[model samples]
Target: MKDLGMNLALSAEEKSLLELITPELVKIGKDRSKLIPILQLIQEKLAYLPGEAIHMVADHLSISPSEVYGVATFYNQFRFNPPGRNPVKVCLGTACHVKGGDIILENFERKLDIKEGQTTPDREFSIERVACVGCCALAPVTVVGQTVHGHMQPSKVEGLVLRARIEREKQQREKQKNESSE
Candidate 1:
């Protein structure tokens, strides 16, 4: 894998992902018909279809990059970029909207200093709006990683953001301490 010369050394996860994608691509065969299946397999493994992965898929299918991307764009399930370390998703389903979900979304954007669909410069977090998260009863919900905060109000967003920041800082400090000790 190092001999492939992509310049940047592949992370452990990246190397494992490549190993997973390579065989599946081969087993499925290199045809246009397998494009979506290939994309699905990649997304299932990585939660997103990266640029290099897209190029590899195109090459395998004997299709142009535009064609591969065109098919992927038609599907909303596909994400082109990797998710942030902490993904913050605001629900915009009908129930949530009636409960001021839009306001909650705006509050997140303002606090994070990045609009929806964008990650912070430090890549500590990302913000996205989703149609539903199966918590309609808990309208105006915001999900950060695996934790859900329901009945969110614009005024309460600061606390949520601040708590996440504090928790992440603590984790970082602990990690540094452990590494230094080692």
Candidate 2:
């Protein structure tokens, strides 16, 4: 995609959100001290900070792009990319590591063809590794959406992907059936 500068070819919804936030940004004014708050505000409003929003914030704050990105990256709470429909978090805590958590994470990455903290092209899945989830007994744990899979194996990742695909297909079929019935 070509560099879209401030607009970034944002969706209609994104544009509307930008318009709504623009006034607040003007109120906040350009201050280095306000950077984090601005980022948080944008994330809360847009779910994730889009490229255009970041640029707009940086421009409004009279800061460099690197400064904005640097601050955003420093905080784990900030998510640069949009989330997928399904958020999968793999635990990499000490217990999980002992149980081959890395193996499980790699399996998920290979299966989804996306690295940790990435969403798939179709936005069907996103997978990331967490330091700990306070469930050591559930070592090698994988959390897909709100469902926790304990004692997870690399093979289980395949089954999970397959199941998700099946479920999505089922939903799509049902929607199509309903449309045709109408």
Candidate 3:
């Protein structure tokens, strides 16, 4: 819903994200050296940069849009498009792979109706593969949100997705409650 091509008024969500980072942003002044922090703040706020936001940030910080976009593109953590509510990361380390992590990943793809690096149609979930998470002692680990489930079996995919969906709903409810109070 963000039009990345135009300079427009900030939405409520955009303003909330800005507010969350204002303290850190205030520490940064007009110097171009702050470009990295500015980009980082934006990325952390929205998970990605709306093309229009790049220009907005550049103007606010007195820098170049090209510079903002360059930094945005350079970082793997910064995405141009919006990501799903819950990003699912599956560890595929050598130990995990040997313990059937590959099958577990495939199981997730099938059950979630989305492939690795792709988000579901409803944008509820996004799946990704990680090289390692240093949890090899518990090989075959899958992380949904911040919860890590070790020694995963292919059959556990449905439950993992279900738990993620439930958590997202709970988070959404909490967000709505806070918004209503505001």
Candidate 4:
């Protein structure tokens, strides 16, 4: 496979993941029509598509990296960056907007120190803006992972972030304890 010379770097874990998925990618076929399925497989394996993996897929299909990226970007299901342990989605639907959803979203940006569609440096949290969460009654809502939090306000941002941190810490500690027991 040819390198696109983008000089993208993959972490040890990412490299290992790519190695594991490469065989499947090849078996799926190298035709350009197979691009979407290949990309889907990669995302399913890695949770998000890494740049190195994108380039490798392009080479495998005898296409340019941009071609792969273009197709991937066209689909909303694809994500280029890694998702955080806690993914925060702010609803900006018409009802939520009227209830000050933008303000709530801004408060989260300030508290998290990361803009929409970006993950924190520590990877503990990621922020995204959603068109709607289908809960107009709870306008100005924020969903963290699978839980829907309603009637959110700017004042509640700090507490929400703090709670996520505490929960993440607890999970980490539990994971460590389990590993030690093993």
Candidate that would win on TM-score: 2
Q: Write the per-residue lDDT of candidate 4 for residues 1-182, one digit (tens) a residue.
A: 22222233455887898899878877888789999989898989888887888888988999998888888878888877677778999999999999999999899888888777767777778788899999899998999989999999887888889998988889999999999999
Query: In angstroms, what RMSD does candidate 1 have relative to the true structure?
Result: 5.4
List, residue by residue over 27-70, the lDDT tens digit for candidate 1: 89977887888899998987777667878888898889888888
Q: Whose lDDT is higher: candidate 2's or candidate 3's?
A: 2
- The TM-scores, one per candidate, come to 0.84, 0.88, 0.62, 0.84
Clash statistics: count for each candidate? 0, 0, 0, 0
Q: Locate the minimum summed-lDDT window of 10 residues in model 4.
A: 1-10
Question: Candidate 3: deviation at residue 143, Å?
Answer: 1.0
**How well is each residue in 1-182 modelled by candidate 2, as lDDT tens digits?**
21212222456987899789999998988788999999999999987777887789889988888788878877888876566678889999999999999999999999998778667767788777899988899898988988899999977899999999999999999999999999
**Local distance difference test, per candidate?**
0.81, 0.83, 0.75, 0.84
- Comparing 3 with 4 on TM-score, the higher-scoring candidate is 4
